[model samples]
Target: MTGVPASAAGGTGRTVPRGKLGTAAVNQASLWNIANILTMVRLVLVPAFVVLLLQDGGHDPVWRAWAWAAFAVAMITDVFDGHLARAYNLVTDFGKIADPIADKAIMAAGLICLSSLGDLPWWVTGVILFRELGITLMRFWVIRHGVIPASRGGKMKTLAQGTAVGMYVLVLTGPLATFRFWVMTVAVVLTVVTGLDYVRQAVVLRRRGLAAERADAAAKAGQRA
Candidate 1:
């Protein structure tokens, strides 16, 4: 999942001055704000998408179209929720956590359903899911050290994956099917390459963070002595 945009204040939120008294009012964003609501909606769509995709034994073009619609809505929300959260300063803890989950949930559901239906290869799903989940865990592993900022290549990977999956969700044939194969190939390549880059960054960040901590502790001991 792409990183949510940083807030206007270079933080998650900000206080705005308001009213005739010109008092500062903290815009305490609630968990139920528009952005978070969109994320929750995407979560709900995951099951609905699966049902639509697998209906009629998972081969009906009309059913697949419906499933694609659900998938499209989920992706559209994925785009807007982050934008809305950043633009309106509606970022919240629930949003921060739920947004990425919503992104991966819908995409995973799409990929798995397609694979289960024998449309896409299971290995493709495995590679993409492994990279996405691994990077997520790696982020947490080094979170105390520092955030691994999203790179251009990482954004490209997300785009490639989304486009490839969306194409697979549709019941395309002939030339279109051939084209999507190549698209998915590109997506898989990006997934593996970017995942390796993230691992390298996590190692460097953790080492640096640990060294800084040690230096601080040594200085504190000297001060006490």
Candidate 2:
């Protein structure tokens, strides 16, 4: 309701319903917005977070706490940005492009730092990083086609990952250490499973997109002929 911009009819500059804006109009929307600002903040936090995370090899509890706080703040921006984008219909091309980059950067940096400190298994880091980067590439590959909203499994994987990373960053001991291991295991499993599913979905979408393009082309040829 509020904060909704007046929609145009397919870039015609004529007012129209927001939901009925044509593809060209939507694509022409401006890059700067509230959501994108949050995304940019996340990007700025990446190097700072990695620095804090790796300091003193993550052995100093005081510094580790600072790193955890930084990571938490970064993740919080992620949550709010997406929410604000969807709630206010403030989504834009720049937000779509920059948002995932920030997510992957922060998460990958954290995972790598943890592995470097010998806090987590390298194999786990390798697998999750592979999946994260692969899926991100897939998203860009299909950027001209359409977007894939995060699936339920992807959401679960994020929760598992965040929880596990928090545990590792906080350096919980004893019983909690065992619990974190199990949580991370779940995260890894979800990571792999959802990753494979994403690949399957991307393939299907690409095929459909190609088919539609071919059909559209043939239609134009027939009309011209």
The best candidate by lDDT is 1
| lDDT, residue 110, candidate 1 | 90
RMSD of each: 9.0, 6.9
Query: Which candidate ranks first by TM-score, i.e. highest?
Result: 1
lDDT of 1 at 22: 29
For residue 220, give model 1's deviation from the true position in Å. Answer: 0.8
lDDT of each: 0.88, 0.85
CA lDDT, candidate 1, residue 72: 87
Candidate 2 wrong stretches, greater than 4 Å: 1-33
- Pairs with steric clashes in candidate 1: none
